[model samples]
Target: MQHIIDMISNGTKMNESEHDELINEVSAELVELYEIEYDPDNLIPADDETANRILEAAFDLLEAVGVYSVDTKSVFTIPRDEIFRSVQNSQRYLNIGEGSDKYLLTLAGSSEKKKTSIMGGPNASPVTPEMFIPIHRSYAKYTDIDSIAPAYLDVPAGSAKKGPANLMKARQAVQLVKEACALEGRPDMCITTPPHIEDPVAAVSVANPRFMGSGDLQEIIPQQGLKVNYSELSRVYHYKMTGSNYLCSPMLVRGLSAATPEQFAIEIAAEALKSQVVYGASVFFKYPAHIHTGDPLKTLWASFAATQALSKNEICLQGSVVTSSAGPCTEMMFYETAVQTIGYVVCGCDILSGPVSNNGSITNQVSGLDAHFMAEVSRFASDLSLKDANYLCNELFSRYESKLNAPEIGKPFVDCYDMNTIEPTQEYWKLYETVIADIYYILQQKNRRISRR
Candidate 1:
């Protein structure tokens, strides 16, 4: 509490009343969420009535604490106690008496643009040579995003037709960073690379030359005007070999067929823990329900449970994206937004990077909206107590468990928001604003209760 206060006092500006209001609102919603979603034994009920109850509870909670700002992208830093209180008040709906539960608050960056600095091949969609400049421009424009995970840079030149070559791809990655920096006037943004690489030496060769690593964060210093940074790869080595403070994200889909999504997530998280790597997990959800028949909520729960088991030092949950084959739709986008935000709050993820749409296609304008929605939800979720957050998540899962596999992918970005304007359309923005306003009202209601007490 003192640390947060000191940080805020020392130039980290925050409006006390506004902050308190926000906290109170989220807390009250969480309390209601607890009643509907969480069982005292930490188990979720499987019945439809319980599920519907959980959904109603979550809807109220979402109405209260789920909306966030999409206009300005900034990190919110507030005291944990306030957040915990908000959740406690919300839990009153469940009749759970408020008890002392120390919560921790951390700053997180919220930028939804899918600008990969690393992977640039056929495997990664919409990453054409022509699209590079535009994407770079987008990155440059969104200076609010603290870091960027450059896409996988292993594809050799002229290999798109023949598939990726064995030739080291890191050097090319360096070139891409340099290019992206040159195009964007500001080169201060951090550049990160994928952890799963075939050649560590080549990967290092490219990163060591471009990036400066100090502790967990890496910075890309412009050498002829370009951002550069290297992140350790963790996919190939698995968690057992790496021991875990590195980024280790195995594709959820790939692991799902052979092992349960939860089991795969646990195995990967365990490896990250062993390496002490600040890991990132990407959970991809495809459309039509034919791909994976499992429950989305359960899959998310398994992933969160795995994340919870790991040491905070070893693993920092970078956000998870709900990817679908059907491209970015409104329902899918919202579903992803709701689930990922809830996961971040309940699971205590370090950074929330996406709601990546079209399985990696930049063509989906809705992807950007999804990103915006994610940022808003993330901000709301950040203001949650760990216990209440867990309960909230359990409730969300209970309500949306069946729909996970066959989630309704909403409208594409083109339909929802105008791409030409580089902002959400008025209609979309109105929807966004309404959601946020409702959430604000919920917070205000909670604040009034706090005053009475």
Candidate 2:
């Protein structure tokens, strides 16, 4: 870990333009080296050859360009040999929570029959202090979710992004999640994430053992397409120094930073490699979001390719979240979640981290019910073959592909769920049941076809 810190402080210095140029140049070279091609039809490949090629491509990218340090204006390069050694020596499983609630989260593979652990919350969605406890309590009350990520307090009095005020709010958010978990009779439930605070002091301060439990997972998010800033790096350093568990999250944009699907896959694999070699994190979570189209298929395709690569080659635990274009109470939202969840699980993800409704845009637009569905789908897909899982994804994607662009904004939490009872309203419940039934019907049909074959 000290080696990582040293590299962060003292690495090859480069300007932003030079960094970008390096990425573009190396990425282009890797595409040719690997003979990478985008297949819109086979979003999730079942074979080992594709996965191996992607893993190798990622290694080449790391050896060629290294990770750019946005804070130090430098690049940290790891030798290919060291990168392989780190991955070979990486941790394969993480034990989270405590006592009876404790869960063993291991690396998932396309062929593995193990159920992935579910992490639920609003995913740092906006919530007033008043709504924070009740909203989180609702999520904790669900028996299916293995962990929780609480919503950030969108305080009305002051800015929630800086200074002592932000620190106070960040601490408050962490305490509120603990309180909510205790209230729901699951005090040991693994809590994930502090509030999305920007102040480095506040961010690092909230991750201490006094506030965050040892079993809980903190986060270190690099910027899109293999860039790490000081703020996130400091948080990871704090967690490591304090002996806490942390997850490395990296996002890849489909066309913006990644340029193409092949590039997107390469970047995610590279980030996953860096998570172990540089960040020293055991769990890696990454997602790809499309820049132009609201359709998540392209994003899902790129992510599935990358995750399959990592799942096959690395020992570290891996996962991705279910982030839909539409908000809750819409069929599109459920459809999107099913597709994303199935893709991630079948391609090899150890944890199911979300159902970030409304693309995590609007405040109070998330629900425990959607997260519940994500968990259920994850468990169901755990035993499925990659071909069957791909079939289900294709079926669900066809249902809502056209609706992606004009997704319904839907209602906020107050309108769809009863805060007093901490349960979804009758209308929302009906939608939930209807969507579940529709999916089961598709699965039933799929099974029938398989039997006939």
Candidate 3:
């Protein structure tokens, strides 16, 4: 109640300040008061008590700080009662995809165990028109990857076309994704639409029910200052009407938003929880912003705290893996990918796998191989308890810790795979095997010995 009053008073002060100034100010101030309780000895915090404490910290941050609306130019005052009501109305089960391809995505917490589905594709990365089909084909063939969101839209790449024409380009992305899935015999796949398209009406105009159907998920991202803008608001409305899902991803960059780990985690929770409270969106994701796939320490800390907070309170899910300076087909790339994805799975996230090579800069820099590697790492990492998961993260981090700055951006998909055959070259497979073998050894060292084994 005091924080709500404070936010109102702060809102008056905001008028005297610029937008970016207020944003930068809140981001810097929010996490400064909280000290990180993350143990160096136990990085993942295996105890249930620790997770609960993290949840408590997150709620306090949410109630005290609340969310800022760039559009309204005022802070959103949280009526505690209404926020709780929205949480009570939070969704527990979600049906993704259409027809026989549909899957009931059940949300779970860090304490409860459930198989996290593999949501694969380019995400929103840019790719050349020629490579889109072949790249998506890579993910579609894998049974482990349940849904697809093809990256690198060929339609809107490098002025090859005119204005964003959001609807036209979006339709092309959908049409192209269908082609890729069809080649892999998975025409009934669920995929994501780019948020660049601002108008929900235009998006619906392009989404032909006969092909696009009603099962697709679109991203609804709030502005950096935690404000829900018209673009995301309309998309939420579109989902409410269509009965589709929106992947609410509020990425809190380490340096940009929060200076420290504690602040970063709190910001993530504030965004995720607010998304649910405001929009009734259940599928939430927290991706740490870094060029080199981010660090395991950062990933585990922020993801564990925020996601544990969400899970404790609502029928919600949080997710994994984003942003890498490292490109595909290099040994260094696999090592970084292995460490980061493993950390996210162990920290507990609904895994969304893909190597956004070159920090999602260039197309053909990503391949099906990158997505495959992410899936494998996340699946293997999920098997370990938090204690062993932490050990594995520390060990793997030791290998790539030095390479975080200016990571080796290796060759893109064209160099690594046989486009016609849609398979990895022998050289790539050999490197992949070697990386997996080393990771296995790391996991083995951490795993307690069984008397029988």
Candidate 4:
């Protein structure tokens, strides 16, 4: 924490342009210098050598460019030696939740014996107060799901996310998730910290043993393109003192600072390495995305490549988030979730988080069904080799490629799920079954295709 403070107080100052220029220049050079590669034909390619190369390039990028402090207008660079030592000594296994609901999160390899930890929920979808408990209970009821990543509570009718309302809402969000878990007979279920309030003070205040639980996962998010602020730095200190499990969640937009999938993967790996060393992040949440769309193929490929690199190098426990373009209750969403889930699990990510429908934009547009299907796919993909996983994802992508641009934004949670039973309606269930069967058929054909080869 003091080192972080020192970085802010004494680091060399640079304007936004200079910082971006340096990032761009260093990123371009690293890509060429390391011969970073991405196979568009085979998104989830079985290439460990390339994966290891990407990880090395990521470390080089960090040592050269460092992390930019948005608030301080300064750059905080760590030496390669320190980065290596920090990663070597960082936490690898994390125990979250308690008793019956407890689950282990470890930096898993691509072994058939490993079980991918599942964190299921609406995943930050906006929701009214009336729908919060029911939506979360639907996920908490699942025995396969290890943790709950609840939806964001929509601001009270006319109020904004500030003042006492913000603090109250933050506390309320945690309590509501706990209530949902208890209702489902899983009181010890791991509950992730929600964005009830954007203010760091209220966020931090509600994040205690009482609200979010010491065993729950809290996220310290970095700003886009390797940037950090005072708020996140403070949370790192607080979580450490409270002995809470936390993840360093970083977002990479493909076209923002990173020009291509290869660049994006490098940036993602660099951020993961830096976060593990700097924040002592118990886990790393990897989500590479396009700024405006949902479930872009290139973004998903980038996520797999980065995760493969990190997992291969044994950086930290990595969690994969599946943000779908389509909404719940649609056939397209089922396909989207399956493809993303397969890629992530094949890449050896330890945790599978989401299938957050509608790109996580629409209010009440997500359902437990999406989470359930994602879990199913993740479990099934655990035993799949990279070759099989690649064939399956490519086949699924081919079916949905044309519909990627204008996927159907299906019904809200209320429409597709029976609130009384907290289960999917018959129509939604049938669609899920149909998609599952179709995916299996595609896998069967993969066998024939391989034999023909």
Candidate 5:
């Protein structure tokens, strides 16, 4: 810790620093992430040894770049040996939540565990306080969804009710979700996030200090990409102070920072490992691309390689079914979710389904049925092996990869789900049923292939 201070005192950046430094603020990540030291695109290695190489490479990148802290405008210049030791010392498994709702979280690819723990909710889509309760009910009612994440409050800066507090939304966020939990009779469902992790102190201020007693998950997101600000660090401190279960994943954009699919795997693998080492994350979430549903095959292969890198560590990783163009209700939305879900399941990783209805730029566009149908397909897909999974992924991607740009953003939640009853309407139910049945046929075909083999 002293060395970090000294390095910060001396300053890590040679140039005058910017306020928001994402992972590799310089835009050129020092590690190319090639295990074979060849082009990752054509010569990708599917073996455990390759994963090892990527892990080492990521560590080397961390060592060389030294993480930058935008809040302090300083670089964290720790020795590589010390960094590794810190990571090695972090706790591996975190048993979270109160009695009935407790979650046993492990590092990504931690073991040959069955049934990936479901953490379902809208992926922080914009939501009014009134709609929030019903939205959460949609997830809590599902048998498979074990945890719930709150939707982002449509609350804007200078909320009329809460005065000028930076965290007014945070407080409202906690209350809204808690209300929904009670309404659903699943008061114990572990909540990993409350809309945003941007303000850790404000985020934690709403908590009952006995977060340990309740066993809910609290997250800390390092600023930019892997860089830590005062806010992220404060959250980490609070997590330890409360003895709460911790989850962190410093995301990496595959297209922006990493030029190819293989680099995406290496960056995410390294980032996930960094979270474990740095944040003591029992499990971390890694996003494949900002392109969302744009490149299904590319994202799948990227997630596959990333999971392979973390598998050796027996770490648990949470992946998302992010969409580029597809939104709720449309067949495109269902198709994209299935392809992304298959990638994670076939790779043997858990899921954080649905932020499904938006391009990276669009907002306020997600719904319940996306997750409703996704969890069903994911459960069935989880039964397949990597070979069969990959074959299925290829077949599924062929359906929608071409239309990711101008996909039909389907109807809002109110239209498909009766806002009054919070149940799916007949039209939406049929849409979900059709997708599930289509996937079942695919699974049957997978079985036939296995028998033939």
Candidate 6:
């Protein structure tokens, strides 16, 4: 525990002043969160109490150093011994899915990647034993992702297929992991399976194992001494409700319905605490008129407030307008990325994921430039301290707040870039270069002022 503390607090040792400041800020924020108006009938007092306790522990650990990543919208801070002990004492493990030796190795390697901390694979697809080895090897070679999440296992809404066959898909996923282990020559991955236990057809049948059963996966995979990745638990939460729906409807709403941003955060933390898995919280920025009043600054502030209120865990607040609803243009894309990055930094998100455009649906060309631009800006902004980052984010938002409602989205991915070269078209690249230069200039000026101080 002391080792963990030292690892996290390497640069910024805690002083009395910093400790007091963190405690006061956290306490005040908790009070403010509790006072927010909500549908009273849906409130959960126990959840709120749990949230407060987590905050208290976080505050007491103020000596721990904290760092924010703009690319991921995630905040990484050291935990105090008491907090770690409390989490361990709570016995909060949620064994969701199956475990496999291969899957475990893939997960461990992915988790060690720099600047990337999450990996996800198709949950429904079944890979042949032949294909599984190559796929796992590809994953091992291509990306340095930290966690591998199960994707789309519960079959889409209109799929023609049915039933226990889904377990086959699960086995195939496990197979992919196993193949990867063979290629890597070392067993170092972590496997996590799904949580749903009750089979729909089984009114009372032991003959067929549940499709989403973690226990079944564990039983099948002969991997001993492997930890399961629990970060994917949120996927179950998403699957049971959202299924394959993409419009972000009541399904996503229900997941969030009962809790305030703060409360939801605590739930996320609790999940992380229980599983000891790397956890993430993300805020999807959709262009909702009522919430932001079409004011980008207000919208950014709202995002910041919500994300800040929920930064207890390894959370990432994704900031990007839904380009599908808004049309495409470079200026709107640039402004949105700038403001979003700023908000993410201020809110202390651990990882950040966009300058996303065309609603994250566009293909390479149109999307790549904005992604690259956003990534650069995010990287640049992350170099600043939280206070300065907040100031800049607020300033940018103030400048563009009036235009958020009708902000330009940008061209479709296929139409915007050259596929052969894997780069944006010349026109798009020129525009991106110009926008990036401008952002750098602004940041340079800010850096100068900070230096003078």
Can you write out model 1's per-residue Cα lDDT over 1-453, one digit (the tens) per residue? Answer: 233223323432333334335434443444344443333334223233443333233233323322221222211232334433333222111110012111121322212212111111112333434444344344334433334444433232555321143223444544564466446554544444532344444443333423422211221111110001122222223321332123333344313221333233333332332222111222111111112244444455444544433313222223333444333433434544455465544444444454445445444232344445555666666665554455554544444345555555455444654445445567666655665564455546656877999
Error of 3 at 446 (Å): 4.0
| Candidates' C-alpha lDDT | 0.37, 0.80, 0.66, 0.82, 0.62, 0.36
Best by TM-score: 4
Span of ten consecutive residues with least summed lDDT in model 1: 220-229
Query: What are the runs in model 5 whose C-alpha is more than 4 Å off?
Result: 1-7, 16-46, 108-111, 156-164, 210-213, 293-296, 315-324, 351-355, 359-364, 446-453
Query: Per-residue lDDT of 335-405 in model 3, one digit per residue for the tens?
Result: 76776676566656665646567777776677777777777877787777777777776787677668777
Clashing pairs in 4: none
Q: What is the TM-score of each candidate against the true structure?
A: 0.50, 0.94, 0.87, 0.96, 0.85, 0.44
Give the per-residue lDDT digits (tens) of candidate 4, residues 1-453.
787778767778888678777777778888888887777778895888778878988898888887888888888888899899989987877899988888877765555357888899887889888988898888888888889888889865777577787888888888998999999999989978885346788878876876887679887667767777888888888888888888787766776777777787888898888887778888888766552264466677777888888887788788877887888888888888888889888888898887788888899888877888888888898888888899889888787678877888899988998878988999999999999999888888878877999
For each candidate, C-alpha RMSD in Å? Answer: 18.3, 2.0, 4.2, 1.7, 3.9, 15.2
Model 1 TM-score, all chains together: 0.50
**Ranked by lDDT, top first:** 4, 2, 3, 5, 1, 6
Candidate 5 structure quality by residue, lDDT tens digits, 1-453: 334445556765533244223434322344443433323232223356666766776666666556666656666655677767766665555565556666675654523655666667775677777677777787777756767766777755555432336466676677777777778777776776665545455667655543313467666655434465556656666766766666675545666555556556666765765675556665677655465444545656666666666655654455554554677777777887777676566565655546446653334456656776767777777676665666666667667767766677777767768877778888878988887787778878878977999
User: For model 1, what is the alpha-carbon lDDT of residue 245?
Assistant: 23
User: Which 10 residues in a row give candidate 5 its minimum summed lDDT?
Assistant: 35-44
lDDT accuracy of residue 39 in candidate 1: 31
Best by lDDT: 4
Q: Which order, best to worst by TM-score?
A: 4, 2, 3, 5, 1, 6
Candidate 2 to truth, TM? 0.94
